[model samples]
Target chain A: MTRVHDMGGRFGDGPVDPSPEPVFKEDWHARALAVTLAAGALGQWNLDTSRHARERLSPKDYARFSYYEKWISALADLLEENGVVTRDELMAGQGAGPSPLSGRKLRADAVAGALARGGPADRPVDSAPKFAPGDVVRTRRPARNAFVAGGHTRLPSYAAGAVGRILHHHGAHVLPDANAHGRGESPEHLYTVVFDAAELWGAPERAGDEVTCDLWQSYLEPA
Target chain B: MPHDHHDHDHAHAVLPPDPALRVKAIETILTQKGLIDPAALDEIIDTYENRIGPKNGALVVARAWTDPAFRAALLEDATAVVAELGFYGRQGEHIVAVENTPEQHNMVVCTLCSCYPWPLLGIPPGWYKSDAYRARAVREPRKVLAEFGVTLPGDTRVRVWDSTAELRYLVIPMRPEGTDGLNEDDLIPWVTRDSMIGTGLPGRPE
Candidate 1:
């Protein structure tokens, strides 16, 4: 009864394997893709200009909070600032009854119902394979700290310039990089690549030591 | 999987197949209602997935598993050493790694916006992603764990890691029951995704 995109759905039923070597991209396009993802981490989109709803909090407060908290806080701040909802209204929990314009409930209904009914989209969910099991690739490192929320990001900096190979083509997943552009981007290929510890963080006496990362196609390149 | 709590009301609840579509829907709703500024949402999503997502946490988990001294170091100052690993996911800047002992168990949840220890646990489990897990984990954790097939005896005290301002916490689950005589290479297999989340114990196939 699980949806294809459900958590832990992409990997095969067998024990998850860790063998695709990391792929390294050589061109600017590959690098740009990496930059987009890194920059997207900072939330500077091509067209995104709206400010957050909460503004009175400390800068330290914003950085210390969880990602979703930041979203909620920002939304609240923005809503109040733009006069969409006032402090009194929100604090009072007024006009908070689900807005009719809200499509979450409706969309959730339609999609869940269709998926439940065994619609075409509900066919045994399978991850479309991309990049064969042994394709070598590399990660791109782009300078993306120029925007707001500059530099302090989640994408591992050690992954920059690291090379490995595609061990498994998990499936397409939402590309946060494009979403950061505020362009409403869709999911892209997700892969698990094995990087030699030597290549990523200098040599360890144990030459075979390595790490497997679930990387988006955008972060990969031909090695 | 607990039927007692999940009634038929969820039958009509639509689960978006595409994560992006789901986010889009949230974005659209927020935008239409002017609940959030478009730019801010962009930043929020950006940080959630990129800045505070699971990838960052995976590295920390892997490192803790490998480095004993680092593991001790993490237990002492998880926030600083986790940063030394070069990963600081959203809400990850402040970190606290809690060890799960034979007597006590640990789990994490953000009753708010999926507040997770992404720098250590990666993306949340599906159950963790749901409102039920988030709301219930904080209030009635014992009930929620029972729902997840995790039952703690009354004698055992389950510590629910509520990620917060000064620090976010991750449960370094007990190494599986029968992992003795196993090397790190072989030991990794016992590390089930669930173990990383602290809901289940790691176990080896007989």
Candidate 2:
């Protein structure tokens, strides 16, 4: 539940390195991204599943993996899980026999159009939003069992259980928690919750500093 | 080529990192399986590597600096306004442009993941994805901004936006003083990727 990937508010990691570099440094990084995007376009697994696959890796390995390495590993895991390819096939870099295609290949010519027309997750719901701007709310501190079973959540560990004010109601959107696990869309009211630094961390930090996060309604309750 | 056991060490030394090799291996296998098209892969890479980048976002920022109407439209509906300028896509689908005033400053981070507006900012920088930045940005934002050589006045209110949903954020950094005469084209260079991300301020004219 409290995985190594969820590194928020913890200390002693060291200073942030502010260096500039190209998006993809090595040739493999670009290839990894390309392969991941291609496989993802197949509609076999959702983004959440891919993310969970990476999180499921051993903490040691997860820590060791670069950004694209994580993506490739997850892609490999998903391919094996979906029976698209075998572990041996992945290892050998060649299939033993002909495999069925996904039939949903993103052609090169359509790349620009596809990117410009991005997927909008907002969905209409039957009910009115529970919270509104200026409403006081407390983030639900997820139970240990729930956290373990939920797979992934949009609620970060640092924001959980903290009290904050709703700065704005962002309308209903697909809940990532359910969408990640192939449960359902389960759209909910999203809010911009603003937490004072003193409220999240402690006093004596900066009095005027605040952290604002877009939190789904399910993750909050009236304070 | 014949398999040679004695050259394994030399082969390993010559090969790239294990991750890179593994990715190449997977790509090869997927291509053989006909699940992935190499041309499509190149197309996707080229789009992000060339077609999309901070320059697109810089144009948006520069317009906001020179034109009050465009700035108002951007702050009100960033998605449509940015799309009007041809910067809308995957992560940039839903954007909320927060303006940095003299009294208040804005910063952005994704504690859960590196969720950035790719169409606006291109691929996120390395530090933005680092554990240190993710963990400390919200806790010690002043310190974090200071490390980036951005020293805000202690009296200014620092607002850190943690992107937890599909709505991506972009900081409409305050227009630097003494730039009233500059046109939108001239102001583009002053706007940096870090400024839009709120890690650093826009470059000042020397």
Candidate 3:
């Protein structure tokens, strides 16, 4: 059985220092330590509490990997279990070996298996598009400190109630998630949302400056 | 699917990478004797800082302090307009200037991820992305600032801006009046990198 979890070692509760000053000077050891810590945060995805979450993973791997390494590991595990790839193949250092998996037409099932196996080179197109360019939108502000369900969303806590306009639409990208329900997420449109200074800071009384931001699809709803 | 069991209101899409040429490029770079190292340094580079980090922001901030109107434009749409000064580059894309005024002060955070104005500021300082900084920066910004040795008057509201991929931030520190006739080129020295990051304000002539 895979190890379910470890205490996340240290630094789990929060930052060790509440008032730690920004180190203006560069330090390699600090960067190494930070990169190591970042790996741990990503590792927690394996132990996610959702029903759709993945099972016990190797603690050794968890403790030693980088952020990207963790992502590659989780993805590799999911794909193998789903018959997307064979153990020998992955270990043999053979990639999913360039598409067209056994002459199967690329579609929902194939793409799904490929994603589980690894991922399709070109991401599948999203069927449902919530908002379009020039749409007036408001990012939903859920009650603070409440744990919402599902994927790792790009929506920031501070931007919850903020309103803005959709400037441009960027096609779908990865939905950083591990929940079972979220496993099927496909590429969707990303929007560049522009907000006026007044709306965010209650009118920049002096210069009346404006601020704009880029937001992924899931973060907005029609105002 | 009318009365859905799940909230389909939000959807997720995972875009796979192009494994062909991209990986080859990454592999070549990684295999290079002394190119880029998440660990070791390439001899050609003194430290990663000069090649890609804070020095970039420091240069811009230094220039802004010297030039008043340019500083004004930078405070405006830093991403779109700052190019006029020939300081445009990759990392500073979508820059927004947060002003630290007598009435209020401003700071920045990338709570969700380490999104920063890399072109202008260079690489983000490690502490900026710490969980401690993320949680405390907003809840107790005044306290956080004080720790950085920036004690603000109670009257000044310290605003904290969280940077995301969609937007980046730069800080507009108050100009020190003592350096009255200093031209833009001469004024660059006073605008330290920290001032742009909103950690410390520019010091007045001693």
**Residue lDDT tens for model 3, A92-210:** 33443433232332222222222122221124573656777788999767412122343334555445678888865545544433222335444455566766545654534223333
Which is the better candidate, 1 or 2, if ranked by lDDT? 2
Deviation of model 1 at A211, angstroms: 35
| Candidate of highest TM-score | 2
Best-fitting candidate, measured by DockQ? 2
> What is candidate 2's lDDT per residue for A95-167, written digit by digit as tens?
6665666467666776678778878878999989999899999997851214236367778888789999999
Cα lDDT of all candidates, in order? 0.45, 0.81, 0.47
Rank candidates, lDDT, best first.
Answer: 2, 3, 1
Query: What TM-score would every model get versus the actual structure?
Result: 0.40, 0.93, 0.52
Mark the regions of model 1 whose C-alpha exceeds 4 Å error after superposition: A1-223, B1-67
Model 3 stretches astray by more than 4 angstroms: A1-149, A157-223, B1-47, B84-91, B204-206
Across A14-67, the per-residue lDDT of candidate 1 in tens digits comes to 221222222211222222222222222222222122211111233444335433
The candidate scoring highest on lDDT is 2
- Total clashes for model 2: 0
lDDT of 2 by residue, B1-206 (tens): 11122322222222234887778877787777677789988988898888888898889999999999999998889999988788888888889999999899999998877889998988888899888998889888888888899999878899999998899998999998889899999999999999999999998745
DockQ of each: 0.03, 0.42, 0.09
Q: Is candidate 1 or candidate 2 better by DockQ?
A: 2
Tens digit per residue, CA lDDT, model 3, B131-171: 55664554455556666777766566555665544356778
